[model samples]
Target: MSEPQHDVDPVRLGAYFALIEVSGLLRHAIEQQLQADGDLTFVRFQILRRLQLSPAGSRRMTDLADAIVFSRSGLTYQAGLLEKAGLVVRNRTPDDERGVTIAITDAGRALVDAVLPGHEAVVERLLFDRLSQDDARTLTDLLTPVRDHMRAAPPRSATPRRTRP
Candidate 1:
């Protein structure tokens, strides 16, 4: 069957494609650097980095999943792997037996410290190097509202699931 046509203008379509392409390219490079530098996956790195940056050096699993826009199951699996590797610890919350809190270990902080320099360099070279300071500001301004609008939907951890009857 032929696809139905939509009435999107050429400029908007082009911008959407360009944004997608740039996102893919940036993610690819960042993933490679994370793997090579810290033997970490991009998602794993994000998890550790967020924990490391948090004031308490930890976060509840659901909050972590929401912040990273990762599925709860996937985050649980990754947290298990990190726990096995001695990079993080998962604990049951005292107030809620069902809740899990993930905390970065010293080793995890060390790994993030090791990997950050290369990650920053890769991002700077691949993205910011092409944009002037003013251009960067303009890009942020243009994208912030779109990001906020998209995030207005329920967070990944909060989204309801469909059940077959």
Candidate 2:
């Protein structure tokens, strides 16, 4: 019951390699800065940043995991750390007794605010500065469809929930 294999193309392989390599380098540098400056892990920073950007400044825990491409248990563990640090809080959603929402605290916003300028600077220096304005736009245009297509598919996670006792 093995799936049929297609011949691999060198160009496509190179593209995948470049994407992974660049993403790893960028994440490492950003994480170092975030840890040093804000005492935050990259995942914690992302959770805070996403919550900060939400219209209601909160999101259901599952939705946050899906949006961030994090495992539900992993996100919950990170959220627990953030909560312990007083950067976030988890609350029961009023309408759904079983639903839990993660909300950024004032401290979370402050940490994000403090970390953002450095984050932008690192990104600009490492990634964007290498590209011309047109290059940036073209890259975005090229990636948008690919990203959207992947997102349209069913989620990769089979059990996308944190196990609650």
Candidate 3:
């Protein structure tokens, strides 16, 4: 028996492939620039940016992992490196002993400040330069729903912690 014809035709597949290719290339360029300019990895840069923008310059480890789609253990390792570098602090949350929070340090903030210009330049040169303002807005509008939908799903590291009564 022949396979049934369905949606996801050549056009859709090509579009998906193009999107993936662009994403990978853009990430590579950004990562290279980030490393060359400041010796920072993309993941570490993201963590610092998130913590810097967060209220109180901190977020729970799990939340940070979820936001970055990183494994909890992976985030823990990165946080450890940052801690050793004096770029961030990791401490148990007072309200929940099982929970750990990662906070950006002054050094992390300074590093981010130093890195932003290069980061912005890389992003703009790779992404924004390829599209008009309206095209960028359209891409955001189209992708936001897909991003929200994926984010709403159960994350891989969302293990529940038991609380003492």
- The candidate maximizing lDDT is 1
**Top model number, TM-score:** 1
| Stretches of candidate 3 exceeding 4 Å from the true structure | 1-8, 158-165
Over 1-165, each residue of candidate 1 has an lDDT whose tens digit, in order, gives 999988989999999999999999999999999999999999999999999999999999988988888899999999999999999999998987788899999999999999999999999999999999999999999999998787788665745444336
- RMSD (CA, Å), candidate 3 to true, equals 2.3
Instruction: Sort by TM-score, best first.
Output: 1, 3, 2
For 1-165, candidate 2 gives per-residue lDDT tens digits of 999998999999999999999999999999999998898888899999999999999999988988888888898899999999999999998987988899999988999999999999999999999999999999999999998887777475422555566
lDDT of each: 0.93, 0.91, 0.91
Tens digits of lDDT, candidate 3, 1-74: 99998887898899899999999999998899889877899999999999999989999998888888888999
Q: Which scores greater on lDDT, model 1 or model 2?
A: 1
- How good is model 2 by TM-score? 0.88
| Model 1 misplaced stretches (Cα beyond 4 Å) | 1-5, 158-165
Judge candidate 2 at residue 12 and give its lDDT.
96
